[model samples]
Target: MECLTSFCETHLQPHQIAPALKRHKLINPVKNLEDRMCKKHKKPLELFCRTEQMCVCQVCTVTDHKGHHTVPLKKEFGEKKAELGRTKNQMQQMIQKCLQKVKEIKHSAELSNRDAEREREESEQVFTTLVRSMQRSQAEVSKMIGEKQKATMRQAESLIKELEQEITELQRRCSELDQLSHTKDHLHLLQSSPSLCPPTSTKDWPDVSITQNESKWNVQKDISQLDKKVRRALSELEEKLNNVLEKSKGDDLKRMQQYAVDVTMDPDTAHPLIIVSGNGKLVRTGHLEQNHFYNLKRFRSRVAVLAKEGFSSGRFYYEVQVKGKTGWNVGVAKESINRKIGGLYPEQGFWTVWLSFQVDYEACTDPHTPLSLKSKPEKLGVFVDYEEGQVSFYDVDTRSHIFSFTGCTFTEKLYPYLNPFDDYDGSNSAPMIITPVNQTP
Candidate 1:
């Protein structure tokens, strides 16, 4: 069959209006006008098999499609056309919904990108300020040490000058006495002896010495202290950064608590002066050193212990109670940490914080970083993300953060480390207790 427009263009001749009546009739031609015959029987497919859903001739209904539900081809065609119209409408609605979803996803992605960029900028700024502060602290410490050395040297130089002057005066007096002794005249010699009974000195020199030890200062000790000050400054900056990030989002305690695990002390790794309870949860310093079986892994100096459980990957959290304790150290340490030389810092695979005299709170960085908290905490929560290399501390009582050590590259398994500082007159006798985690509401 030929399309109407093509037929009109070829037969109607140029400049002809083309008959509208024929065009309109062709557009709405009756359905089933064309005879579609099945080749098997060469018969027109005038009937439809509803069960088979295919066009069929009358003979097919009686033979191949025998006993099957059948309807007129035109009637079935009308129903199917109506069904197609409904399907088209549903397809259009689905397409519209998918387009809206695409828009929403794009908007969310844009917001996420913006947040990431802003956070990146903020982190850069914070680190820059921290570096500057550390540099200034280093300069100040160096200047102070240099000035002390100069002052001591100046004092020594002034004493040397006064001693030289006394020696010169004594030498002059000896020379005159020698010249008088050599004189031929006895009267002259006697007069000289009377004058030189003793060279009159302004002051008596009795046991005067400028010992170097008295003027010497422990440069390493001074530098270590100054390093602590610098670390404290850095810690504060980091705390502020963490707070800002947390505030922009929400508290991370709940998320961290999800990884909470029970921690117990390992007696084998403990110092002889340290005692771990049978349950492994409690640890305290002993007044008298216990003669336990000799162990190579035992702490040699500081009274500290390591937990039985060690983590190599993923996150973990634990809680400890330090109530009534005057001094204590609690945190995590790498498995390979030198237990023999127990009092270690982060650089030496020990990441910890300590309380001294129940007043001073500090983190054991290379140079101990002092923490200034709003209030002392009896119960503390520790969180560690091994892969992320983050160790954080929280004051569980106030639900406030204490400090966090980040940007570490962990290779070995890390275990919880604890230290019950030496008991001095029983003032620091309280145990560093590891307690069960009671999730905060």
Candidate 2:
């Protein structure tokens, strides 16, 4: 029985419990079991777990770890679990933050795309508008060019027709001359052979001869008159045509439109005392003893003044003089005219001319109140200060600086005035001379 019992125990146990144990001994199952055992061995004391103090297991204390400092299994497990929990919570927060950041980036990108799209559309619109405007301008320019071309073509055609007509008329006149020459030759032959009274009709031979001679004379006179008229017409036409051709060559056409004022100053009167002149004669004089006055008759018909025809529409230049005197106010008056005096003054765009003197001198009053000769005088010069007024003083050649003055005003409605007290003296009657700037040769 003992043997039987042993046999049964061995065989049945092996078949049943052994199989169950083997199944549990599989790698995954054994690993799970070992992990459980490890955890069991690592379990901490209840007090250590509750207090979170240091505690360890047999597995931790064996071998090299024997007698080594260790923390309680429960405490270590609690700490690890709590740390793992914190890590999980942190990971969850990080994911939430990442999602939020992604959302912000996506929103910004969408907005930027929208703005870029709008800008692109606006740029396209502007480009289109510019293109259309350019096209319109191009069309206008093209139309203008076409019109000019047509006008040129018409002018050329008209000229050709006129030339053809002239040639035809000349040919016709040549043919008439040839016929007259042949008829004259036949008449001369007949007159030389008067003995051959060929087919004389006694009825009216004399009458016919007289009538034919008279008609030939009349024809010859008519031809002479026509030739004279034609020659004259041709000459006039040729002159006009040549002029047109010359004008078409270049900008020289503008030269024909200019008018000139040939001023010839008297060698003696060409002094600085004369402020203004017309036809080379002194229109305004500055004398040492006389007040400022103007000669209206001296004003030229073409003189440019504000009241009259403003400065001629074309380029013009003229020169005048200004004499300096002591204490006597004198200058060119621009813009204004003196109706009473029949001239333009500062109000009419006239400017005054003033000169400076190195030495002290006496001032001259108006012609009505002349200066006394007893007043001593010295060197005189002119000054111009743009800040005070637009008037500027330049040398007779206008290439050098004379002087400048500030705080001076000139009558606008009257012609420019000159005071001899400023500089003009019998010895130095002429002090200032003016010429139009940029005069043509």
Candidate 3:
């Protein structure tokens, strides 16, 4: 068989002409016409196998595709073209979703840049203040040293003048006595001897050396006083830095609150001993395990519960009140974590900060790092940036940062976690309450 390209009416189709018209062949304006022929049967495929959703020849329909619903290939082509239109619509929707995600990423980057700039400015302010303080202290100590040196020089000059005058008087007395002895004048000699014998008219020349040691002692005393001033200045500087840090924390708290979300306890994932409040705002441990229906989501051991809400992307912040609770754990846990024996480690799908023994605190990590906080936080703030892989904890009462888990890789949805830590002793009996954040003014 041969093919030719021409207008449909002008070209003589080979199938229509006899073998004598070997110069002419059918011209198909549509591309890939050969693909319409069945390879095995060497025949034009005219039917479609609805079961296989593929074009087939009539021979294929009665043989390989027996009992399968078949339709005209031309009809199937129309349906497939319409189906492609629907697929194109679906692609548009997927494209729009990706565009939305791109916008979100860009917005987050912008926010991160803004925060970095603020941090830089604040750091410059603190270092500038520290440098100025040191310079002022240095100037004051230098002035004291210079003034002391001048005073010492003046005292030495005054003592030297007095001693020089006494030497002149003694020399004059000796010359007069020599003159009197030569002139044989007993009265003059006696008068000069009495004056000379009186050890000159100098005022008590005993230990008349200007004591450099005394001046040194005065400088030392000034230095000691300067030390006290430096200590006081340093203490003031510490207070000032603390004030700055506290104000920054307050500002950050307000910012974090902008992402604040309302959270409630979920009883399904809670331990058997845990009790979720009616309002779902609080959770506590009961002395005895409650009789409940069997649930795979429930925590059978640890006295912990997950919030009803879960986040897979972006940022979220929430606060919890642990005022009366002596021991508690608060943070986020990845979905699909072990419910039977929940472990508070990132490896175990938990990123958390916990308090134990009333005062000790730790950020749950692979090794669980210890944290020493200055003030006991009656209220705690938890913030998570899923894309950035950061989970931070704050002391709401003191407006201070307690700990942060950084460099994490989260691939699943995260749920807010809370545990009241059911201690055998009645000390940790307080319920962990989800509270509204009080943003500092």
Candidate 4:
């Protein structure tokens, strides 16, 4: 003010001066302000440019930020603080969700450990039973051979005793002959000779010999009988094992149904001859192509369709009805299965069970093995454990496992597969209907 001379320095009031000015810029005071100064204009940044989302001076609103919506800095600060509070609440909710998931994962781990222990105990028992059966069979066979050997020893001992007795009698007879021959009187000798009569006991010593025929053991016969017995025992064990396994399968089916998924047919993937229902639950082969537009995803030759959903992880289950279908295949196939040409078998990325027109059922494996199902499954259940790499088919009505494809390596997503074979002679024209799963109690 003294330099300008419009107001005298002597007239300046020290009470109006800031303390920072006297303290040598402890904070910005009078001569040079801080970052609050607008770079373009030498004015304080007092307003927020709402359009640019930044602090601006009043001069900046008319210059770089012309015709911009501006608000007081204090008002924008309050709004931003409220938004941060809302974000904090959202983060807290997310953290709670994460914690809840942690608890679920821990519970699942506990169940898995329990199941593993059960399987371990069961396996040990089965192997132990098998070993005991073999040991018992071996002991029985050994004891039979030992009895044969003992019987032979007894027969030889009896022969040795008889020979010793004969030797003693012969020796006694010779001694009596010697004594009689030495007698001096002829009358004594004649009397003794008539009494001796060759010391005959009416038995020939030359004919008395040990039996030379050796006792032969029919060991091969015993071994064969033991083999047959062991095989029979194994067969019985197998039957028992199957009964136990089927019972367990019934229980497993109930657990598997918990992962049941609603499956709908993917019409885009259906073959031209296949007619998909409007609700996407059923599909059947028609007499001729239904004039549908050709889609690249469709199965060109095979009369098959895929479910709309595909799974890449975890377990899933679905059921289908083939009550009247004589020739159909139901199971799962990988997404990369050939849409052009190939047999629908495991080699072609299909794990399925099939029924032919002659009512013959088989699993479509590499060698196409036959299946000895007790009865045809009117409704079939397909279960896939993606991480386990297992695909199983079950007889839904009977609650029995029909077949399982195990030890697979699935790198791609798998889809539910349905194949109603070509309607040859119209005997196998029934539609395969996707049905809801009814879990076993």
Looking at candidate 2, the ten consecutive residues that score lowest on lDDT are 249-258
lDDT of 1 by residue, 1-441 (tens): 123233455553432455654442232333544446565766667789989888898789878999999998779989999999999999999999999867866865675577667767887888888989888878987787787778778877987898899999888888888888678998777766675786676666666555455544566667778789888988898897986685434345655676789898899888989989999998999988888888876787778888999999988999988888888888898978776654567778988888977778998887788899888889888999998989999888777788999998899999998888888798777787888877666
lDDT of 2: 0.41
Please identify which of the two predictions, 1 or 4, would achieve the higher lDDT against the true structure: 4
lDDT per residue as tens, model 4, 1-441: 112122235534342375633432122234534466687886668799999899998899889999999999889999999999999999999999999878866866675576557656665676678789999999988887777778767877886787788779989888888888788998888877765775555457576543333333365578779989999888877776666676667767877787799999999999889999999998898988877777778898788899989999988999999988878888998898899899877778999989987568998888888999888789999999998889998898899888899998888989999988888688888889988787677
C-alpha lDDT (0 to 100) for residue 436 of candidate 1: 80
**lDDT digits (tens) for residues 108-142 of candidate 3:** 66866787688668767877877887788788878
Q: Which residue segments of model 1 deviate by more than 4 Å? A: 1-35, 200-232, 244-441
Tens digits of per-residue lDDT for model 2 on 1-441? 111122344554553465554442212112223333334453322222223233434554663356555665556678889999999999999999999978966875675576556656655654565556556655655565565556666766766676677668667766655555567577665664533333323245233222334445655565566556555655665565544443332212122112223333432222233454444434334453223344542332312221121232222223344443223334443333332344223344434333334243222212122223222322212232233453433333323322333454532222233333332444434433333433222
Cα error, residue 32 of model 4, in Å, equals 18
TM-scores for candidates 1 onward, in order = 0.46, 0.31, 0.67, 0.64
Give the lDDT of residue 47 in candidate 2.
24
Estimate candidate 3's alpha-carbon lDDT, on a 0 to 1 scale.
Answer: 0.82
Candidate-wise lDDT, in order: 0.79, 0.41, 0.82, 0.81
| Stronger candidate by TM-score (1 vs 2) | 1
In TM-score terms, candidate 3 sits at 0.67
